[model samples]
Target chain A: MEGNLNALTVVFTEFYYWITVVVMFLIHVGFCMYEVGVSRRRNHMHTLMKNTMVIPLVTVTFYLFGWWIYFGFQGGPGITGGIGDAPFAEPWSALMATHLSGPSPDLGVSGDEAALWSRLNGVFWAAFLLFSWTTASIVSGAVIERIRSGAFWMLAVVIGSFAWIIDAAWGWSSQGWMVKLLGYHDAYASGVVHGIAGGFALGVLIVLGPRLGKFRADGTPRDIPPHNRWLVTIGLFLIYTGFWGFYAACNIPIISPEGIAGQITGETWTATNIYLAPTTLSAITFNFIMSLSGGMMAAYVVSKGDAFWTYSGGLAGIISASAGNDLYHPIQALIIAAVVVVVIYKLHYWVERRFKIDDAVGAVAVHGYAGSLGVIIAGFMLWGQPSSPYEGFATINPLGNFLGAVIMFGLLGFLPGYICARILNAFGILRIPRKVELEGLDFEGDETYNASVAEVIAAEKAMV
Target chain B: MSTNGLTSWAVDLKDVGAIYPFQGTETVLVIILLVFWIGWHVLQTRAETREFEHDLAADKSGDEQRKAIDRY
Candidate 1:
């Protein structure tokens, strides 16, 4: 703690992110509810457990190495510069553990770095960790009712703690190569979080195959209505609410001119997007509501008033516009959202029927397709814009953004997902056995439940 | 040449304001958004009416209605 003003700023920043982490927790809660609601009664327990377990598994692994990857790989090792130094993020760093406001003997962290990290490290890590869990949970929803928990958990770690973090290093970070070279501008992580997760889901689905009975004899897709429409609606609403926190968390709540250390020449304190480019809460708020409204309206018309599609369309709308929401005119966001909803809704069914790949929810369309489209659109909408405040960065262009979208959805998102799923499948652990799947993944739990009920009934009758 | 008229963020933050793209089109954008907001309700009401009509026709026998009530 130096000056009183400086001290207050640090404390405020810390508390700001802490609150965002809390709000973002609702995103997971929403995902769990949404997945459980969509699954049949026989699959409820398994679905809930599958999504819920991503939290602990991804949390532990993220703490172990995920944070390090963000700072360590910012260079693309050579694209922007050499491998950046990020000792504090390393697992063995003393700063990684609880330490007082002083230098450490465990690692070579100086007093200043240690002081800053001592207060900020845990909260920052947590904010990003929530993102990690979200990425993994996105995949979780698409594979519900059929994927084994153990197998899914492994996939969760790959996306949550490894794959997504690597993309964050290359795309989302301020000095990330994509930001430097491609002018990739995903202010709310349309590509970084949703795009990658969506691609990862598609990768897994390609190999995991459709859930039994998802297709008819003519190879046509069937409508698998959610077991509980009320739960699904409520869950989607909660997700919408939690997304406010997600948006806030993507920003530097406050930063001074000196903090940015780039071309941004100013004494004014302000909020910056992930790439250290300026934006406002007011602008993003306008775009968020407008895009959401646009999405819901378009979805209603396109789906002919289907409840599930309407809600999912709203989410898709927000996601489709999220890449440029930081800078988009509110109306531009709305129209873009409307356009993407129609495209994604059509694509969702086309992909389902054409490939017979079952996505339990329209995750691939909502996250993957919308996310990719948002990124490409941002290239044109924000064309000639600086991706980062730093010098030598490429201006935002359609080609750059299109390439970034492909890398996010195809390279980082899908490739690893397919490879890992293939490995899991070879060992006969990817999908559950057909008999158990048909009976439900909760069959074992059901057996125990029945046994307990029979015993309780028998005991009560005897007493009577 | 940038979308918001600033090619770089090198300027002082104190001077910087309203970074959203298409800076002077707020009025037009507002009009468009207003139309969308109003149009949504119009479309939604019509869709809801259609849905109700379909529901009435399909469940004319009242068997499905009874089942729904019973399930509840």
Candidate 2:
């Protein structure tokens, strides 16, 4: 009901986020396809279902508590402040539902707050929820065959609804403690989503162990080619498309200096990263494409033109440069991505051989290692840049970003993931039984379908 | 009265807010949803355990397993 400018801004912002949410859904679709494609034919249904179910499971739990965690724990809940306020994010908040800007008795907010949140909250929550699903799905691929579906779902909830959101709160949010104190600056969620999920998957893989026959008599890891390579190819392509949406979602889209209310001066409107520092859609697009190209080229050479690693390398490359993509020159992004891909590709095999981590889909290397390195790289590249528009906050630095990466990959990502998996493992529910793993995860379904086919065939033959 | 306190659309849109029904019962609904979610996990885990048990008890002949492997 305000002037046209305010109306257009609010509506445009709302619609912008809504479109991102729609596009981001392809990430899960891609995840489901990729996980299924990589798994053996015997494990197809189980792998697909395991990844597919993350959507509903994470969606509901994110609604229940994950959204609250993002808004409520931005201060680290203790480091710089106590649990911060985010009443609108609470599951029980009236603002969480359909509203049209006017205040109600049950709104628990002023008219202005209600107006702002009524249009924006659901879409914002949904965008974050997609990130949450991506986090869980990253883990889903790494531990496909042997992870008990129930146990994995529980772990998914832990990481998707709890662990990653907390990392996002401390590092990804504009006023997060990490930004304020550690000078953390991930323009996109190179670490907040990918790093945490990758580390989380690593922790789970450590306990779950590799699928049966994933290792040989000499203890060297087996190649385990995908049952269907086409699925993997298309899946990665879809993920790349969805990533465009993910990048857009990370920005504020449009905001004026007054809207940001920070050191950013002049009447010019601009898009901002999650930290509320200025960037542009054009800048990210340039960096995204260049870094992706760099990663694919490096990976093709490093992995000797392996289709799987090449695609994954492209993803890792984008993730590697994503931390500073907002401000990075396209060439810098490409070089960083290329360099990071080579390191991560070598490290992937090194860890697989030395530690015997059987990452079925190379998720740990692509997301976790690359994301952690990306953050640290950004600190050096964007050295001394303001982490926020707000006065008196820490500026981006190597040490701060390195610590932020550790916090993302180790403290928030790996720790919670390991602890949850350990608890589930202790209960004798983490891994499927040896016999079941050998028999294939889809034994029951396969048996039923086989019997149905046989019976129908016999009946038709008799009729003939 | 309507649950969201809107009896008609005759009023100004700017003066309206939450349009969902049972507005004040959000807390109660949330508690129920949480219970349902947790309960689903419990039921699912138990069922999965039973399924594994059934599979284990059915056969160790290795013939079917071999066929399944051959199918792969």
Candidate 3:
């Protein structure tokens, strides 16, 4: 508020994130369209609504506690330290709303708190809120056609507002214990977002079981093609578009060494990843395009030019390289992305055939399997590198990253999801009844649509 | 008479802490919003149950089922 350059930088950073939030909205639009495209004609509306409702439910819940958890649990509340303070994020905090940087004792904050909260709080909270939506939406696709919206909404709140945010606190936060002690690094959340969501979907699917008739008498799986191929491809394309915003949002757009107060020197201002480690958006852009190309090409050959796998491969490709994309060479990113997609593609079928676990959209393979691989692969690729610009944190290594992946995909992602889903199943609210599913989850709504169509047709014939 | 402390805009803008009316009522507003949010879920869940029940009965004729399958 005092000086020109300082004020401009703060305002610029706020506006930068605001734009990213708008762009990231497309990711949800894509998820909604993707689920609708994958569902059969009968189940279309139900599938779309089931995913759509996650928005408001998760937003409200995330506002209630999710933003607080990101700052509060950074310490593991014991491991690295105790619960950290985040007064600005509190629901009742005046800083949560419009305010100038000038002091406000009514809100019970010192001038320092006012300065940070006035500019960054709303946009930062909004940016993270979009990520919460993405995490829950990832689970939405795998459980389509049969999951009760009531049950799914609860699951969305758990993943979007609670479980995933805790993991972000643990791994993605700058002062997080995982980063402090273990050197757990996931720059773009390859494991944190995609891995956890994919695993959560897998856990729910295990208890929810397959859509009826997914497996035959011999226990072989059947292919359920998407009702509309074009929509699925377009959905994936929109996700890729929004992913640009996600990447930019993950960075502190521009910060000086003095601002970060870390090991970085020379007063250089640069874009830093979630851990406040220096990285250029340019470096990640090269890796993003390279990995995506590698995934599409590899998916084409492996799935033999299947449109669905090809598009999903593009997504899996970027996700597989995302962990190291901030630091990786373009060629290195490409190879890693291509290799992970091939392995995940093969594993998807192997799991389906061996376990008879029906993942409707291969979300488990594309997200969970590929994302974990990306995290572990980054360990080898970025070995001996600083996980943060901070002092005394462990250097990036295989063991820490491997454990981080396991914690993300299995421990945090799968375990709670499985337990909660099992409870919901025991109460028999998780999945629709067999008869209702077969007749179609959207049967009544579609019935009304068809009735209206028939009435209109009869009236038109009489006029003619 | 205003819920907000300020009765006029003649005061310096910088002195203003919260512009909205009833600034001190934040906790009350939050409580109300929370009640509305949770109440909405309860009501929606009930409507969902009723809608599912109706759909469950609608397909008893089997004719609609055949038509849907044929359309597929």
Candidate 4:
């Protein structure tokens, strides 16, 4: 607390991240509402609880090791020289707890690193923790109804605290191997968060199989309409609102030239993306609204004004433009969003019918397909552009981004999901038993309810 | 030349303005987007008409409609 300006900036940055974490919490709330709304009445309670529990399960596990993965693996062990150190992020590290802005003898963190992290660590950890919950929640929606709570929670920890964080370290970090060698860029985590989650959901879908009567005997898919269209629409709206905070959280808030230590030379301070490249809040705001409008309009036409698709399309639109939202023109964002929505909608059905995959919500298409497409499209859209302000990094290219998309969706996302699901299935814990699923996961609880109601009604009659 | 006219970000932040790709093609892009916007409505109206016609022809006995209403 030496200089007034320095103290103000540090406190303001902390408050800024704290507010974003609160707003981003609505993303999980929206996911719960949307999932339960899409599920049948018999499955509502189970669906809600299943998504809700991802919060505590992921939060604890993320605190234990997930935060460590982000800082420790940014080097790829070979790309940025060797295995990086992150003692401050460790669970038992003294720096992980509350401390005044001074170097501690209890932790191995250097004086310089400790001074910077002392104020920023908790809020930064919280912001990333919110992202962890979002990634896991994305998978929770696609596999509702038949999945066991135990199995789903295990999967949540894997994706929430492990898979997505590893991908973030690889692609989203400024000094990531993908950034250094491949020029991989996902400014708003289209591929890092949405793409990977979507891919993991698809991988599980392949092994878990469809919910009992998802397809007819002749190989045609059946439409299982949402129980509450209003809830689903409102949920999507809330998600869109929460996404504003998500966008802001992805930036550094404010940084001077000396802070960045990159090639951006000036006394002028500005907001930078994850890679320390310059951007502005005003630019992203324009693109966000424009892309969302483009998505909604295209979805209204394609789905013939279906409320669910219209809302989901707005999400898809933001996701499609998110890769380049940091730099895209509003109209460019609009057209890209429109084109991507059509592709994703078509792919959703094509994959559904071809594979008999029953995604309770259109998560695979909306998040997975849209996200992957966004990354690849950005490569072409932003080709020959610098992925980082740092020297010696490869320039952004179509081939690099295409490969990066595969690595995000298939390598990190799908592979781990399939392996974990297969192991769980072999142990007979991946899905509920056939009888329980057919009767509804809430069958026992519902029976207890009926019995209690009968006894209460009889007692009231006797009193009368 | 890069899409945004800067292949590298190794420059002063104060000098940068618009960083989006293809800075001068805004008019052409808008025209194309307008066509897409208009075309969607035409296709949507046709699809809605066909769906309603199918619904009208199939279960006019009100059994399915009643079930749908009750379920909601």
Q: Which stretch of 10 consecutive residues in model 2 chain A shows the poorest summed lDDT?
A: A103-112
For every candidate, C-alpha RMSD to the true structure in Å: 1.6, 17.0, 17.6, 2.4
A379-408, model 4: which lDDT tens digit per residue? 999999999989899888899899989999
Look at candidate 3 and tell me the lDDT of residue A82. 92
lDDT of 3 by residue, A1-464 (tens): 65787788888999999999999999999988888999998898899889889999999999889999999999998998898888888988888888887766476667766886789999999999999999999999999888889999999999999989999999998898998888887999999999999989999999988988889999999988889989998998899899889988999988877778786656557787999877788888887998898788778667756889988999999999998888776666767877899999999999999999888889999999999999999877676667887788887778899999999999889987898899898888998988989999888998899999999999999999
| Prediction 4 TM-score vs. true | 0.95
| CAPRI tier of model 2 | incorrect
Candidate 1's C-alpha lDDT?
A: 0.90
Estimate candidate 4's alpha-carbon lDDT, on a 0 to 1 scale.
0.90
Please, what are the lDDT tens digits per residue for candidate 2 over residues A23-89?
Answer: 9988888888888899898999998889888889999999999999998998888998999888899
Worst 10 residues of 1 chain A by lDDT: A101-110
Each candidate structure's count of clashing pairs? 3, 0, 0, 0
Model 1 off-target regions past 4 Å? B59-61, B65-72
Give, for candidate 4 chain B, the lowest lDDT window spanning 10 residues: B33-42
lDDT of 1 at A8: 85
Q: Per-prediction DockQ, in order?
A: 0.76, 0.01, 0.01, 0.66
